[model samples]
Target: MLLEGKTVLITGASQGIGRAAAVECARAAANVAINYLGDEAEAESVVAEIRSLGREAIAIRSDVADPASAPAFVAAAVTAFGGVDVFVSNAGICPFHAFLDMPVAVLDRTMRVNLHGAYYMVQAAANQMVAQGRGGSIVAVSSISALVGGEYQTHYTPTKAGVHSLMQSCAIALGRHGIRCNSVLPGTIQTAINKDDLADPEKRARMAARIPLGRLGVPEDLAGPILFLASDMARYVTGAALLVDGGAFVNLQ
Candidate 1:
C-alpha cells in the first residue's frame, strides 16, 4: 500500500497505458480520478472496476489538448478527492509520416496534444498541489522516441522529446515546493499506437528482433514503474526519465 490514501489523476484513462495506470493506482490503495476524452462507457467501466477494488474512482471527461480543459479537470479532482497527490499526464496522439510528405495538420495535432497538452495539464495540476501546500508527484508519459528518433514518426518524436525537456525543467523549478516531476519513456508497447504496425507480421517480427526482452511490451508492464514513481517509494526521485522499454533503449548484445 505504498500509495494508500493517495489520489491520482490519470488522463486518457479509458484504455491502454492510462487505464492500466488507473488500475495499478487502485491496487496501490489510491483513489483515482480517471480522465477520458471519449468513450464515456469505457471510462465508466474503469471507474466501476476501481470501486470494485474497494477504492474510490470517478470518470471525468476532458480534452487534454484544450487549454481551458485542464484546470477544469483539476478542479473536478479537488472536489472529489480533497486534493491530488499524483498527476499523470497520459493523453497523447501519434500520427506518423515521413518528413517530406508529412501533413501540417498531423504535425500541429501531434504537437498540440502531446506537448502543449502536457504543459497546460501539468500547470493546472501543479497549481492545485501548490495551493494544497503538500508535496506532490507529476509523471508524464513520454516515449522512447524522445531518446532514439524513429523513422516515419517525425511528428511523434519532437513532441516526446519536448516532454523530456519539460520534465527536467519543471522538476528543477518545483523541487523546493516538495513537488517532483518525472517522465516514463516506453518503447513499442502493445497498445493502440502500434496496432496497425503489429498487424503486419514482418513489422512485428522486426520490432521483436530489436527488443532484447523477446516480446512487445504490454500496457500492464508500465503500471508498476509508474506507480512506484508516484508513491513515496520514489520520494528521492525527481527530474528523471525512467525508460520502461524492456532493454529497447539499451545496446544489449
Candidate 2:
C-alpha cells in the first residue's frame, strides 16, 4: 500500500474527482476524512464505500469557503485519525460567465470558494503538519483553464491560476519543514459541475476532437496522479503544476 497508515483529508469529496481520490486513497490503505459542503447523503455514501474497503473514513460537513471551516475541519480530522499526513484542496466552484456579463456577486463567490478557500485550507493543513513535525503533502486541484483563457470562464480561470500560484509559493515556504506543495491541473473531466456543457453531444464531440487523446477525462483518470503526488513517490517533487489534460494543452488544433 502506497499510503499505508497515512491519514488523508480531501475537500469536496462527496463527488467527482474528490470522491474518486478518496476511494483511491482508501484503497492505498490511508484513512480518509471526506469533507462536503451540503450533500450529506453523498458524503456518507463515500464514507461507507471506504469503510467497506476496510479503511477508516469519516464524513465532515464543511463549507471550505467559510473562513473558519478549514481549521475546524482540520482539527476534526486530527481528532478522528490522529493527524493529517496529506491534504488535498479539491473544493472549488466554476461558474461560466462572460467577462462583461459577469456579476460582482458571482465573481466574489467564485473567489471565496476557489481562491480564498484553498488558501485557508493550505494554511491550516501546513500548520498542522508542521506541528506534527512529520512533514506532509498538499495537492490543490487546479485546472487547465489556469493556463489558457476560457471564453466563458473569465472569473473562474483566475481562481485556478491563483491556486497554482499559492501552491508554488507554499512549496518554497514549506520546504524547510519537509512539506511538499504541488497542484494537479485536470482538463475537461465529466463531472456534475460541467454535466450540462457535456450533455450536448455536439459540444462534447467538438471538445473531444480538440484533445489529442480523442476523449474527455473521467474522475478516475485524475486519481492516480493525485495519489502519486500525495505519496512518498513524489518526495522530491514540489512547486509543480502537473497537467492531467490528455494532451489537450498541446493540441495545435
Candidate 3:
C-alpha cells in the first residue's frame, strides 16, 4: 500500500525482476506502465496480471538501449498514467563470456543496454519529475557484480557498476528537485538471462552453497526492495545502494 495511486514506469518488465516488481507495485495499488522489447505476448501477460490486481496497466514496447526510445518510453507512460511518479530502470542483458577473448560486439552491446539504457531512462524520468514539480523516485537495478568481479562476465560487470554510479550522480543532480535516486544490487537471480548457466544443477548447487541464505535469488526477491525505494517510506533515502542479495554480499570471505 506504499505506492497507492502512484504511477510506476518500469523497463524490461516482460520477465524477471522487472515483471516481479511491476506486479508487486500494482499490488501496492500503483498504476503501472511496462516497457519491453522482446516477446509482446510476455509483456502482455504482465499487463494482464497487473490488471487483475485492479490497477491501471499498460504494456509499452520500447528499447531502452536506443537513445531516442527513452523519452518516448516515458512519454508513453505519461500519456497513459498522466505523469511519472516512480521510475524503475530495470532493463539489462548479460552475455557470459571469458575476458581473454571477449568480442567487441558483445562488450559494446552490453554497455549500451545495461549502462547506457539506465542513463537515458533515468535522465528522461528525472526531467519529467522535475517538470511535474512534485518530485519522484528513480530506482536502477544494478547487480552484485558491480561490487565483485566475475571470471566469465568480463564485459558485464562494468556496465552494472556504471548503473550504480549513475544513480549516485543522479541523486546529487536531482536532489534539489526532491527526486530520490537509488540503486538495487541483486545477486545471482534465477532468470532467463542466466538460464543456460544455471541449468547445470551441480553448478547452481555450488553457487547456492556459497550463499549464506543457502539458495540463489529469484526475481521476486528484488520486488520488495525496489518497491521500498519507490515508495514514500524512502523519502529521506537517496544516493544509496541496497543489496537485495539475501546476505550473499556480506558472506563473501
Q: Name the best candidate (by lDDT).
A: 2
Q: Report RMSD (Å) for each prediction in the order shown.
A: 1.0, 0.7, 0.8
Better of 1 and 2 by lDDT: 2
Stretches of model 2 off by over 4 angstroms after superposition: none
The CA lDDT of each predicted structure is 0.91, 0.95, 0.94
By TM-score, how accurate is candidate 1? 0.97
lDDT of 3: 0.94
Worst 10 residues of 1 by lDDT: 244-253
Clashing pairs in 3: none
Write one digit per residue (lDDT tens) for candidate 2, span 22-92. 99999999999988996899999999999999999999897888989989999999999999999999998
For model 3, how does the per-residue alpha-carbon lDDT over 1-253 read when each residue is reduced to its tens digit? 8999799999999999999999999999999999899999999999999999999999889778899999998898899889999999999999999998999999999999999888998999999999999999999999999999999998999999999999999999999999999999999999999999999999999999989989999999999999999999999999999998878889858
Mark the regions of model 1 whose C-alpha exceeds 4 Å error after superposition: none
What are the TM-scores, per candidate, against the unseen true structure?
Answer: 0.97, 0.99, 0.98
Clashing pairs in 2: none
Backbone clash count for every predicted candidate, in the order shown: 0, 0, 0
Error of 2 at 50 (Å): 0.4
CA RMSD (A), model 3: 0.8
